[model samples]
Target: MITVKAPGKLYIAGEYAVVETGYPSIIVALDQFVTVEISRSKSYGSIVSKQYRDDSVLWRRQGDQMILDNRDNTFNYIISAIRLTEQYAQSLGRPMELYDLKVNSDLDSPNGKKYGLGSSAAVTVATVKALCQFYQLPLTKSQLFKLAAIAHLDVQGNGSLGDIAASVYGGWIAYRSFDRNWLIAARNQQTLTQLVNQPWPHLKITQLTPPKNLQLIIGWTGSPASTSHLVDKVAIQKSRQHQVYAQFLQDSKNCLEGLIRGFKDGSLDAIKAGIKKNREILQGLADFTHVPIETPTLKKMCDIAVEHTAAAKSSGAGGGDCGIVIIDKHTNVDSMIERWKQNGITRLSLRVHPVIDLNKE
Candidate 1:
């Protein structure tokens, strides 16, 4: 049996704008993870998840579509990971084998409430990592990220895939999204192996070293959100509000670049200021698009953090889910937590997962 774990990610800065190619975002890998365990099976391959109550699902591919053999529609990203990873493995002349893939997760609360910790991305990365190890494929981190991103895009069909970078790289990262149009065009014309080896335009992933005093805190609103729905709504409105959307992209890029500088210089103040500006930029987006990027509860969470001498904002698509707080290590967050508790926010205890050698996984 081979087991691999991929850490979940939280977007520190830059949200909607990061979807554009070459836009930058700062993301951190949370200690929470989705673990995949695989073992050879003689009969038929099966996929099971302890996160859901549904029975083990058997999957089959009818042309490009993955047909689930069971009623539950879960395993969307996992199935994609398996299919794409296997395609890459076969491109290398590796034999495919049936294996029972089991998934265990710490991305949700005990009552099964998701925390918006990028569980789908984590599971996809974990599955890909496991299969690569199984096949003994000597792939670089970039190659692994490419395979996982391709798999995620095949299923999601949207988003920046920054979470996949965080999962593959771990720790703090500055990620520039690749040109999806270019990737899609290349995928159609080139073999999987050829595509994997090609340089993805505007794609860059760099590990960051945060200052010692920089502290990150997470607060869950106890309400889950659909990132795709939010992103879809924003995309629909962008055509009508092209200039505003374009300005947002520019502002977000500038803000994230400043934040990256802070990470490099170990300046907590610069980081905090950049985070505050990014929050306002997202609010502007919400106002124009009317997509409710930051809910009333999330605003309250951020307000409380600001009152406590910290910078805060909604983490992801942020209709609900979690919001992140940035504060110095010397600051006391107990009062902020108390205020959050009074306002129905639950603090998460996740920390950054340390970076490791990806090939060894």
Candidate 2:
């Protein structure tokens, strides 16, 4: 059996802007993950996914579309990734055998699918890795990234690809779309390589996690925004050279700089300030950044978060997924969570960890 575990990701900055003129985005791989275990089956013509919620096994066919049995409709993304990988293998004259693939995940947010923690991307990465391993394919990280991006775009239609990049590379990564139409830029490649290749004298990764007392809360806005729709809208707005859009980009850039500095220096105050400024910038681009489904709920969450914390902004493709709030270490997180609960918002507590090399273990 070949087992692969892939990390979920959270975008700290540069959401919509990353789609067009590539901007730097910082994403961290979370401990939560999707695990895929693949083993050969005695049967010649079937693909069985035992961990599926409803339809546990699918009959494989040469030209048939993949089937997913999950009632939640999220399982389709997994099926799409598998089909794409299989197709890619065939194109290279290295077709893989159909197998009984049992997929399971511990990455679902307690609040469910609305938390926007890159569940789809995690599944894609995990499945891709497992398939490659099963085939004994020697693929570079960049190659894996390209395959994952194709799977994601096929499933989600429009995605930033940053989440998959972080999952494959496994660390805090500064990623951008490059001129080659590839999802990741090569400029920041060396920085990521250096961090992974060298060991810090005092940093023990197993002992490290996001600080316990730091106030970071993720609140759901009760709406799921279509990433593709929002990206298309933003693209149109940028083409017109809207002033608000320009300011939004500039603000995001400035905010990213501040956050990078905060990350380097371990300054909580600076991080808080950067998040606050970044939220404002996102709010300014609301008209173009979000479709109708995103505006109302996102605004309400932003308003509520601003009232209680130092900074709050929508994470991921925005519109309405989750909003992250930065508060002082001493803030009453429990009380704040209760308040959000009363307002029908679910709260997710996350511990951010530095990326590690999966190949090392």
Candidate 3:
């Protein structure tokens, strides 16, 4: 049996702006993970997961194509990974073998409430890694990232892929989104294997290690946010308010750069300035688009964090999910947690997850 794990992710900055070309986002891989296990099977391949007990697929290879018997389409992420891996193997004159797979996630509550920690991206990365390991495919971290991204984009259709990059590489990273137009054009012109094998120069991921004196706290608002719906709303607004969005994008880039620079140099004041500036830009975007990207609860949480002399902002495509706070290591965390609980916010115990080379391990 082969087991693979990938960490969930949180966006520290550059949420909407990263969708456009050249804008960069900072993302961190969380300690929480999604795991995929693969074992040799006798006749057919099947998937079983706590999230998809009712919608599992019993699949088999039919002349270079994976055919599903059930066709429920619930686990498209897993299926996409399998399909892409099979095609890549075939391109190298190696056919895929059948296997039984099981997926499990620690990204959700036992009751199945998602934490907006990039669960889908994590699972997609895990599945891709599991398949490659099972087949003994030698792929570098960048190669694995691109392969997982292809499978993930097949489902969501549009995203920055920061989450997938974080899951694959781990640690804190400054990532510029890939050129979606270029990727779409390439997909139209080539097979899946050919598309992944091509060079992608636009995507840039750099590991950014913060000072040891830095600290982060995540607070869950007890509600999940639909990132796709929020992104769609912003896209519609961007179509009409192109100039306004263009200015916001520029300001966002500056703010994100300042944040990373400050963190790297251990300048608390500079980091605070960057966090506040970025929050203001997001607030402006929300007002311009008439979307409640920052909910009342998120506002309250940030307000409380500020009262404690820490910097805070909404983490992801925030309607209502998690908010992040940055502080010095000497900040009184207990006091902050008490304030959050008083305001009905749930504190989540999460930290940065380190990346491991699975093949070496």
Candidate 4:
């Protein structure tokens, strides 16, 4: 049996703007992970997930076709990963055998409330890695990211896939979004074959480690945001208000660039300024789009963080999820935690996940 664990991701910078091609976003892999186990099956393929329930889904393969029971839809990403990988292998004249899979994750509460930590992308990356290891496919990180991304996009037509890139590369990364329109069009024309061959989609992912003096703190707002819904709303508004949206994107780009430079130079003040500017731009977008991208609770969390001399902003789609705060090492952790608690924000324990070799699985 081959087991693979992939870490979840937290968006450090870049959100809605990353949806467009050529725009860069920053994300860091979280310590929380989704694990997948794969082993050869004698009769039929099956999936048992400990994170969701006690039920299992059984399936069988028939000449490149995967037939699932479809009774349990809890692990659709895993199922999709297997199916997409199978098609990819066939396109390359390399077929793989069926396997029994088990999946679980740490990105959820005991009662099943998601932490908005990119659990779906983590599972997709783990699934692809496990299957690739089991089949002895000599695929690099870039190749694995592509396959995992295809499966993720197959499930949800939205998202920048920055989360997936973080899971694969780990650490701090500056990622440019791939051309989703091109991938969709290719999928429509040649299905998975086109994606399998053209693994690189002009997407850039570069690792960037923050200075030792800076620290990252994550606080969960207890309210899950629907990224898909927000993305759709933003798309519609952008289409209607082209000039405003374009200006927002330009300002966001400059803000992120300043952030990158600040981190490289260990300039905490510049980083703080960048974070504040980015948050304002997002608020402007929220106003123009008529969407609550920044919830009152999230805004309050940022305000509190900034009061403590930290740079604060909402991560990911920003309706109501985790917010990020960057402060110096000398900052009082206890006081900040207490302050967040008093305001109904739950401080989550998270750090940048270290890079690992997926092939070891």
Q: How far is candidate 4 from the true structure (C-alpha RMSD, Å)?
A: 1.8
Query: Relative to the unseen true structure, what is the C-alpha lDDT of residue 149 in candidate 1, on a scale of 0 to 100?
Result: 97
Worst 10 residues of 2 by lDDT: 200-209
lDDT comparing candidate 3 with the true structure: 0.86
lDDT of 3 by residue, 205-282 (tens): 888877777787899988889998999999999999989989999999988988888868878778777877788999
Q: Candidate 1's residue-wise lDDT over 253-306, tens digit each?
A: 999999999999999999999999999999999999999989999999999999
For model 1 the TM-score comes to 0.96
Off by over 4 Å in 1: 59-68
lDDT of 2: 0.64
Q: For residues 238-270, could you state the per-residue lDDT of candidate 2 as single tens digits? A: 778677677777777777766777766667777
CA-lDDT, candidates in order = 0.91, 0.64, 0.86, 0.85
Best by lDDT: 1
Cα RMSD (Å) per model? 2.0, 6.9, 1.5, 1.8
Instruction: Please give the TM-score that candidate 3 achieves against the real structure.
Output: 0.96
Pairs that collide in candidate 3 are none
Worst 10-residue lDDT window, candidate 1? 59-68
- Extract clashing residue pairs from model 1: none
